[model samples]
Target: MPESWNYLMDMDGVLVHEEHPIPGASEFVAELTGNDIKFLVLTNNSIYTPRDLRARLARTGLDMPETAIWTSALATAKFLDSQRPNGSAFVIGEAGLTTALHEIGYVLTDRDPDYVVLGETRTYSFTAITKAIRLVEEGAKFIATNPDATGPSREGSLPATGAVAALIARATGREPYFVGKPNPLMMRSALRALGTHSANTLMIGDRMDTDIRAGLEAGLQTILVLSGISADSTAEMYPFRPTRVINSIADLVGNSAAPF
Candidate 1:
């Protein structure tokens, strides 16, 4: 890797696990900050806004500015803004999603919406899902933040955006357009936000299906870290491969002497 390379890193598995910072994850971030390397923390979870996420990471000892954090909500909002400016939608999500849409001048309504936007939330509402189904059946476009079937929690895996989207799809017979990872649109949007070229960027992620695949499709070199969801044997299961594999972010800390 070159000295001028920028970084795009997954949030949950790469830097922290649930509510705690992964080993050396803080150091890696510090190294990047101290060295003035350009990077952004990416997450498919649209439950919290960037400000909320920044505070959450701070609690885990990861010192990142709000500007350094990017969420699926932001990407979705940007996509919507470009596709249909000032459009209305029946949104099923929390602050992150709603705030993003609001920032883009999108109206949130259940009446004759132009789209049905689905995002991650701790408590999925039956009433909202039903309304979403009705809206989609009535000709609203279906859109989802990501294709993740499950999200991690202290107790266990919880049904995420993808699962809920599947339910809506089943009822309405319409597959949603996912705006997050593996679509390349999310990665491209992040790259444009960071103002960096894909050739000079490194995408560090924990999932082969989402982060690595998205990075690869977006034309960036990818590194698979085994600190989160993927294990050692997991990479081989995928047809595509990462540029390199490492135990965790610890290996990359103070790696000035070696290729990143």
Candidate 2:
């Protein structure tokens, strides 16, 4: 195995910001390939398939192989598969969440669902929330893809997957099975895919509450990069701290040297 440290990365801030690539982000990713660093893209976004993500990255010249990317959707699917219980789920997110659950063998449903899965559902209504609550009361498991309070938007920000989950929980008086960062489930899946010892790996992301927390949960070193959402001011007052803080991935590794 390569003695160079392995890296687990979160998308969005750590990589491309929205549709456009962050400055030097493409070259930064290329450096990973150049160094045989054994890095994997582990994103909390439950939106795209591995293939889709790979293609998206390719547009920016990252060209990550399908196997190197693991989204929260895939992790959730794997988690459901491990349980091996057959049940239908009522999902509140878009095509990504639904496609992921179906790919994972979860039977997505609206009538008499075995579980009510919630995410960033823009079309949510009181009726849908009521039905989901009723299903939960009927002894169905309640799952949330992630508890992100807000999602990044060009207009500033909007409600994240967690906010929708909170609505369902409040209406039903029950909690949700959150499956994203800070939950440990997603981190475990990432480590398994990378085939690396957790202790030797570094988790790099822009969020302190989720990404860094998940790294700590998975027993890996953590680094915070300011290229995306996290701010230096927040880190100074954060309850949890990363092992290192840098301006961007460009600072540590460039297209110049082998992985350290």
How would you encode candidate 1's per-residue C-alpha lDDT over 203-237 as one tens digit per residue?
Answer: 99999999999999999999999999999799999
* Cα RMSD (angstroms) for every candidate in the order listed: 1.2, 2.4
Candidate 1 ranges with C-alpha deviation above 4 Å:
256-260
Score each candidate by Cα lDDT.
0.93, 0.79
lDDT of 2 by residue, 126-219 (tens): 7877888889988888988888888777788777778877877887789998888988889888888888888678888888989989998888
lDDT of 1 at 110: 91
Clashes of each: 0, 0
Give the distance in Å from residue 1's predicted Cα in candidate 1 to where it truly belongs.
5.2
Worst 10 residues of 2 by lDDT: 251-260
Error of 1 at 154 (Å): 1.9
Report the number of backbone clashes for model 2: 0
